[model samples]
Target chain A: MSLNESLDALRAKMTSEAAGAYEEVLQRLDPRLLAENALKPGDVMPNFELPNAEGKMVSSLELLSHGTLVVTFYRGSWCPYCMLTLQALDLILAPVPGQQASLVALSPETGGRARFVKDKYNLRFELLADVDNAVASMFGVLVRLPPLYRQRLLSQGIESETLHGRKGWFIPVPSTFVVARNGTVAHAEIHVDYTRRTELDTLPLVLRALRQYS
Target chain B: MDLPQIGYFIVLSRVLNFTHAARECKITQPALSRAIKRLEWELGGDLLLRERSLTQLTEFGRAMLPLLEQVQAAADVARDEARQLQTQERAPLRLGLSPWLAFPLIGTVLREVIASVRSTEFSVSVEAEPVMRERMLRGDLDVLVGLRADTLPERFNQWQLFSTGAAVFLPRDHLLAADELIHGSRLAESVLLGASEPEALPERILSQIVRRLGRRPSTPHRASNWETSLQLVRSGLGLGLGLSCWPTPPELVARGLADRLPDYEVVVETIAGRPQSRAVSTFVKLARASAWMNPANVP
Candidate 1:
């Protein structure tokens, strides 16, 4: 199945299995507020250095020095939707190096969890651990999980502190940003609905446009 | 009185692009232009020389920039103080510290500050050097305790707290663990673990490595903080660099580098010439007086 199809299937199963929990989360999380606060196209992407799955430091400015940078912020490897998105991006990442662009995925998950995700998915690109969600917060993708949602996750044996190495129940809204070599955001897609994601096909078009401009 | 206009001017000066400045200020282009025009009218001087290709600050704009920054900073402080007062509370001094500094030293510094100012509270954050410096400049943090760097803005006043030499950390079973002194080039073949933040590693250590190897040492594994870096070294992923003052973990052995690198100085820094609240001033005084601030008292 396609990434979107798999994500949609998981979302459907989740909502049906726990309708009340889904409704409570939807009621508390205002998509409009998240969208407004999110970094958008034309914004200047902030410079940051984060540790990848193998614990290597990957820097945005240094990535741009090589070429354009494609950054994605996800919730965690445990999330099925995030896994689907990552797998899809992994396949798409095959051509990025040739296009003179580097792809990196960021999550609040600990280095161990990030390593798991990279190994499980056989990802070729960098999977960075945004410790304490510092970089995610800077990108305006970080949000505290609502109490009800936190309770639901906890009941399911998913303790955030164990997974993220931090006590706060916070996660980044799934976001994809294509930053040009000049540091301007060429394309940005922030999905309040965790299951939704930017299509892999659209990424190349954005990169091509940015390359043309450069 | 026109704080928004001053804000727009500041944004404009940094970006030097009207469209970008407007977007950053979340105002329409025409609105930003009008605000700047009004500001110029109020001051009776042109602030910018707008051209098709470039926007240059006028002589008056250059003269007024510092004053405007002061006004904005003062306004921010006043608003923050007033809000604290309304809540019947004193604003906790937001402090940012470098992650690689010895953790026990941080606890001691905090204890000193708290003991000196009984009523004051502190919210401490351990961040990378660049992030901490940025937060300090943005006024989000009141003080920064970290290694001194030449790259820091001239507006910050730094008080040297302590100085320590660099040490190399290796796994217990690593071949170099038996060495009393490890040569920089000897470890060139191993994956060097380091703090992810560039500034966390002292320049002298990197320079020594480069001078010995005829190239910059490649760090294959980098951790977000000192603890993680040390953990990587313990796991045998790579060697780690740390301050000699940091307590060596039971599983890791720290050896001094053969070539003497410069000592790293930990400093307490605050914005220069900025007005400080009573709580901030008290913290600064305590920091200055702390035993840690005395080089002679350094362990």
Candidate 2:
């Protein structure tokens, strides 16, 4: 099933009270400049180096050096939508090496949490911890959660600080960037609505086109 | 008036999915659909055959595809030219160099050239060779300093600067450190340290060695850059492959490879058949006259 359809199925199973809280959070979140101001195709992507789940440093140049790079940013592994997206990506990206491309997912979660998700999903790609969302901010995906929403999540036993090992209640709007080997963003998809994401199959097609064009 | 809409149409034609094409164009699916509809209205024909599961172009769309591609390419050239004009108004020279070049040599050459040429503001970008070539083609870069494995594209005019060889770097305490030249046969059992990216030059060189040896070495650690690769060698993790001219750290020893590796020529490249700006021409002139272009002068 498609990622959106899966998300819709999960949403249907949520209690009305939980559903209402999610709706309230989404309503309070302002997405006015989020998508428009985010990075776009033809823009130069900022180079970054972050620690992977195993604490080894991975850099943007290294990923791009292979071929086109697919960089996906998620709020954290705790988000079910993000997990579903990661699993979908893992399935589709199994043949990425054959396509001469690399995939790396970034999250504000700690290395431990990233490792947990990586092991749980049996992900073949590198999953890096963005630490304090510094890399996400560079991509213009960082957003501070509304106070009431943070309170609601905290009351539900979801503490961002404890999960991410950071004090800020910040998360990156789920986004994906297809960066060419030239370090230019060939495609960027920033979805302020967390339920949406770039389709998995489309990424390999973009990589193939980039190789052909270059 | 909506040239970008036409470009979007071209993208949609390729992807055959409104949602995918809209995401590529950074617009909503409805917006892209509306744009296509407006285009069809203006052209007086339906360009696409839409269905629940299948999206294909009609007869008119097939005929318009090549023409639209040419139009988009021409528009891009125009925009690139305008952007280049604006850039030159502020900085006379926007130079890009490849990271593989010996930094000290290029640094010295650039310093000498910039000092000799007065009132010419220079902005520099250090990037990979492919990126530099793309920027040069797009008119974003005035000149490029990089290596070419084969014949360059006809659009680029290139002048050979200097050539460099490759070497294998091993830890100081390694058994191979005592040898004057390291051979692929000797590295059969040793672990190789290389850049994580498969396309990196060092990794390519390592693969070449593996091919020659007929047996692959165990590569346990892959780094992101030359520095990291060297560090891995110094930390006794594995041996590394690097350019002969790169400065060696105190904890490692660099030796010539027994197998003759191909020599890469560092060259200065600019767009061919295009009128050169004063800054570009002057820099080229200085580069030709510079001692750094001669192999004998290089350390």
Candidate 3:
């Protein structure tokens, strides 16, 4: 099943009131602003360096130097939706040793946490720590999770330490981008609703198109 | 409810300038114009008259502005009420603890409070004294745990927690680290650190040193906050002054002042006559009864 199908199944389990509340939260997220500020298909991708799972610093410039780069910014291991999306990406984008394509995931969590997620999921892609959402903000995808949404997250079993960040629950808008070798954004997908994600099936087409730059 | 669009439109209605209106809404001009257009489409008809260098609300737009704002206000109030209802069930307890109390000391009080209180969910706000006081007064915070105030406003009911003195923190290998007690004059000998504006307590602490020693700090550099100041001190930048109650980090040892700085009284304050939630009242009671907060333990 696709990532959205899995998300739909998860949503189906929610009660009517819960579903309604979820809808309201997404509506208030201001998709219009996200569209205005987010990186476009032709926009140049900025270079950044973030700590990887093993505490090694990873640079976007170095990643692109190899080939096309597929980067996804997720919430973290705590979010079930993010978990499904990440697992989907891992299965669909399995790295081919010296192919002209690379995959990496970044989150605002610490490198120690990225290490745990990598180990538990056995992910092929390198997971990097974008401390304080520095990389996400560069892509114009960082959003301060509403206080009420944060409280709801806390009320449901998740510990405060996991959600309440120094800047108070900032998470990326669940964005994925394919950058060409020339550093221009070849393709971009930013999900404001979060329950929806960049369809994993589309990556093959986007990558095939990136063959020119590769 | 289309609150976002209508909210944007309402702001646009007032400013009568797309650029200025967009600036007010914190969105781009094109985005604001698009929102106004979408809202007009939804409500049926042109709501705004946009021509070369001219912006004005049409008759329908002017008529809808008040109604739209009313609807928005009603929506906001409903949302807030619902949030409060949801919150009342098992809301987050906002605890503002001043640096005047040590970490372990606050930890002990919180552990006991959670055990006794029905709700275990809580958030801690560590800020300068004036910010915390204003937050408490504005009802943004449930309770403020500490700040040595000689007198609080009549609107607040305060419980005296304890009296603790301030101390100087130094890197273990610093020249003055061997001194039995750091005198005020000795503190003036080195560079000092303090937080910049809006963090009033650190400024007050730094100022107090100048008043007693009768000289400004040799050369003071400002840090963003207490933690940053401590980090600078740990890096051996200079001496740092802070509440004696803050837990001393392993890298730095705290020393008392030979010149007695007046003891600071940490107090627990909440709005007077306001009905206290179980969490708030329980926290206050537990804090009051905590043995570590007892006044007799500190000199």
How far residue B83's Cα lies from its native spot in candidate 3, in Å, is 44
TM-score to native of every candidate shown: 0.45, 0.42, 0.45
Q: What is the C-alpha RMSD of each candidate to the true structure, in Å?
A: 20.7, 22.8, 18.9
User: Chain A vs. true chain A, TM-score per candidate?
Assistant: 0.92, 0.92, 0.91
Report the lDDT of model 2 for residue B195.
71
lDDT for residue B84 in candidate 3, whole number 0-100: 38
DockQ (C-alpha based) per candidate is 0.01, 0.01, 0.01
Query: How do the residues B1-299 of candidate 1 rate in per-residue lDDT, one tens digit apiece?
Result: 24567789999988888999999999999999988886665455688999997998999898778656644553454344333333434536888878888656456546654553345677889888778888888888888888878677879866565568889988778888888998877867767875556656634466667777787667766787778878788787888888887889998888998877778877778896666653564354334433343222321
> What lDDT score goes with residue B121 in model 3?
82
Please rank every candidate by lDDT, starting with the best.
1, 2, 3
- Please identify which of the two predictions, 2 or 3, would achieve the higher TM-score against the true structure: 3
lDDT of 2 at A55: 43
TM-score (C-alpha, index-matched) for candidate 3: 0.45
Cα deviation of A203, candidate 2, in Å: 2.1
lDDT of 3 by residue, B1-299 (tens): 14567678888778888888888889998878777775554355688899888888899788767555544542343233223323435645788876534556667556655554436588898876678878888877888977656556767766555556778889988888899788888777788777675334556676777789888876457765557778889987877777777778898988888887777666777776455554564455445433343323221
Alpha-carbon error at A6 in model 3, in Å? 2.7
Q: Model 1 fnat?
A: 0.00
Write the candidate numbers in order of decreasing TM-score: 3, 1, 2
Model 2, range B188-260, lDDT digits (tens) per residue?
Answer: 8788886755666677788788779877788878876677778778888888887887788888889998898
